[model samples]
Target chain A: MEALVASAIGLLTAVGIYMMLRLRTFPVILGLTFLSYGVNLFLFTSGRLTVNAAPIIGRTEPYADPLPQALVLTAIVISFGMTAVLMIMAIGGHLEAGHDKVNMSDTDDDTPEVQS
Target chain B: MLTAAWLVDVAASAVTGDAVTVKITHWHGLEAAALWMSLAAIGGGLMALGAYPRLRALWDATPRPEAKAIFDGIIEPLAAACRRLTDGVHNASFSRAVTVAVLAIAGAGVWAFSGGTHLAGDRALLPVTPTVLALWAVMVIAALALPFYHRDRVVALVLTGVVGLLIAPLFALFSAPDLALTQISVEVVTILLMLLALNFLPKATPVESAPGRRFGDVAVAGIAGAGIGWLAYAMMTRQPAFDPISHFHLAQSKPGAGGTNAVNTIIVDFRGYDTFGEIIVLGIAALVIFALSETLLRSPTVTRRLGAIAPVREDGDRHPMMLVVATRFLLPMAMMVGVYIYLRGHNLPGGGFVAGLVFAIAYLMQYMASGYVWSHARQRYDHHALIGWGVLVSVLAGVGAWAFGLPFLTSGFEYVNLWPLEEFELATAAIFDLGVFLCVLGAVLLALASLSRLGLRTGEDVNTRAFDINPDAAQAEEVR
Candidate 1:
């Protein structure tokens, strides 16, 4: 069961990394979403391969590692924030520079002197 | 109980054996797998059902927007501008609404934090202190920012800077000391630079007109803020899995490397290569700024006195006596505190980050208490030289470590045997600390000086040649 889950994660990671290498903003966003899923699944599966255990420890039951789950939840939110920031910056840059290209090529003459 | 269950499984295993030989079947939990598969199928089926009409109408119904492109291009930017202006004008009432919303959200957040702890069994969710504290801070900041936003633009800008400054503590809370220090210093310098830059811009004004259309701004802001709050709350309920760097810290901290501070140990020893790259990036950034300084300044859009501000005469009056005196008294105290922070950083809550910023504020208060003219006259260092020296010092430290047959940031200590005192470890780590300190102080002042010298529009007209030529040249520049 562990092997299977590991293999699944590996596959997802490979695909996600590949997509991340793409030059376009849209695909990069999609890639990030995919990568996040892979990461969350990988993280969730680290608590040993349990069939019946949900890690939601009740009054009369043994407990699972709840910390990893908590962390994964945070990763989800932070990733969302990052995605939002990335999207906004991308869109704003595209509009201002009049190009949706990933490279900052079009603003050769028009680029604001970015400060240190 | 767990052992009992295992014993029961063993007993069942023995009962099925002829010679006590029991075999677990392959795909034993295949039924559970089937249930999961069915769930996936159901979700896929729902998606297909929803997507079918969209697939059919992809070309026919999804043509470009029916409105004229020109109409949209004109309206969108104008509308966005109008909205921003309207929000700025009606900021007082909007801020009140925000304050209320933030309070309610924070209250709910506290309830959630308590509920999370309560709902947990033996392996209950850990009470995440930082997340809770961060939430509280956000709400507090939101509430506090509103008054300043309504009253004064400078105060609003400072409030924004405070929010950025708070990012350092958040980073520090997460145990990323280097990141925290860098972030705090950068935030301070940037804010100072901003204030100086705004010396050319219009003074902040109260909304003379009736503040209306505020409901739209309030609703939008509330929704956004609420969404963020809930998202952070949901995330706080998650778990921690791994620390990939712990092994390196433990294994290589002593024999492989040398340092008691595990974080600094890792940063200077293991990831020294990354530090080198970052410094290179800093160098490049500085170079870029120098390169673009001319054209960026010369840009047609950067004309002085472009926005018609209510002009003040050259005879600048001092602010109320109490403010000046109060700030004057605070300056020396602040400077001493900054020095203390810088000196005592290695042991306690104080650090180079806070110290450098405290120093900047001390400088800032000098200008505030005294006139800008008086402060400018008392300027000590050549701002350009300070910047160059700071960067050079940081680079030299990195290179110095490299020269010792170690990596770029090889941090270690050599004991100095003095005549009167026992030998002590003068850790090279302190050099990095010093470099950071100098960079922060110098860069901050440089940015302030550069921007403050932009235009003489305020009651801050200098007794310089540019002051005479500027009104006419700047007026012509504004026209063009």
Candidate 2:
């Protein structure tokens, strides 16, 4: 089970990295999403894998680590904030550059650059 | 002679426990005469050596590596190599930099792994059910297929959403119901936000990278994935390096924080300061997005660019009557659920974070059912003010603790037996949770609303009423 979960995390990370390496803003943003999932999962697993051990007191003996859960919980929300900021930046970049390409080198003239 | 005299004075001081006042002349003896003669012989030998020009010249011309020159020789190339590496890795292309960063991280992880002692943990592994295996297979497939279909932006997003959706169930299966709730709600908001942003972005990503370059990226990505995966497995299979502090939290959660849910207690009580900082960050992020959207809308170039792209309007009712009516009823029920979740959070898996998201989703549903113009017209609360009030309320709650001579966020709860109700516990942590709830609600709504402003710029027809076809119009015709 640990192997399965670990492999899933790996695949997500791989896909996320690949997407991040794309030349456009949208893919990069999407890649960040995938990467955050992989990251949150990695952090959560640091508490070690447990089943049927919810951290509510008096509900289960030897509860799963509440610390990691709390950390990941905040992480999930913070990642959302990060993604929103990235999305807006991407939008703004696309508008100013007149292109969605992540790289805006001076030599590349695929689209006319509009001065902001 | 001086050394012999000093030694004699030290002996005297040690015996008398006083300052060194014994005179050298008083202690002078045959040993002092021998010491003076030896010092004179050494001084005369050094003076004779100084007079020898040949010996002095040889000493000056002796061959040795200059420390400065040798240091430069070793450091100059290293400095140039570092500069070259930085330029090559961090060139203008973000993609290349990210690729380099990924490889570097993976390499570092591998290096650390190799340096450590490895032992298969004695802890027994959990048995995987077939259902879990199926979910895992689906998730892996979705993630793997995302890049392949990434050129089709919508498909890629759907695949990404699929991966996110699968994660919630995995959290539930792993005994993190709070995480599961948070993940599902966050996923919804994220996908919705992305969808709004997608309206302005190009629908399909253009293929720019060469096949060879893509293949290289694949290799790099594969290496990173494998490294992280192996690391996670190794860590999960082993016992923690030290005993986890979660036991302490679990033990104190009920008595100290006055909550049955240890996770909630840890978030809102034990680590409330971190949560406070997190909410502040969330508020800042929302403000940034809102500011950017406002700035973008004001730019004539961006406005022209948006105008250039033809709006893609599907052949369907802008606000379907069925969805509008259903959501209208669902809104109140959803709000009630959010309230129930928030109130019961201290004892259950629900908490401020999830409840805030729930409320945001309910409002989001109304926006979806009705057009932005209709929804925006009805929204009375200012999102910015909501965020500010949230922070203020939370700070006030924390400050309330100081009145009792306790530390900030020091929660005090009492079981209240009010008339017409069973006994229930009222906690100051709940007030802190209220602050969390408000901030999250405001941030999510503010961000989504800000993005929707871009949609407003796309020249879509605005709706003044909730539904496209008013139900009362037909009744008015019969009266006429």
What are the lDDT scores of the predictions, listed in order?
0.48, 0.90
User: Residue B58 error for model 2, in Å?
Assistant: 29
Worst 10 residues of 2 chain B by lDDT: B21-30
Predictions' DockQ, in order? 0.02, 0.76
10 residues in a row with least lDDT, candidate 1 chain B = B118-127
How far off is residue B274 in model 1, in Å?
4.4
Question: Interface RMSD, candidate 2?
Answer: 0.9
Evaluated against the true structure, the overall lDDT of model 1 is 0.48
Q: What is the lDDT of residue B147 in candidate 2?
A: 84
For each candidate, report what fraction of the true interface contacts it reproduces: 0.00, 0.88
Which residue pairs in model 1 clash with each other? A67-B239, A67-B240, A68-B239, A68-B240, A69-B238, A69-B239, A70-B238, A70-B239, A71-B238, A71-B239
DockQ score, prediction 1: 0.02
Instruction: Compose the digit string of candidate 1's lDDT tens values, residues B151-182.
Output: 35466555545544554454444333433454
- Candidate 1 displacement at residue B53 in angstroms: 62
Off by over 4 Å in 1: A1-116, B1-155, B158-192, B202-235, B244-247, B250-316, B319-336, B371-373, B417-419, B457-459, B463-480
Docking quality level of the chain pair in candidate 2: medium
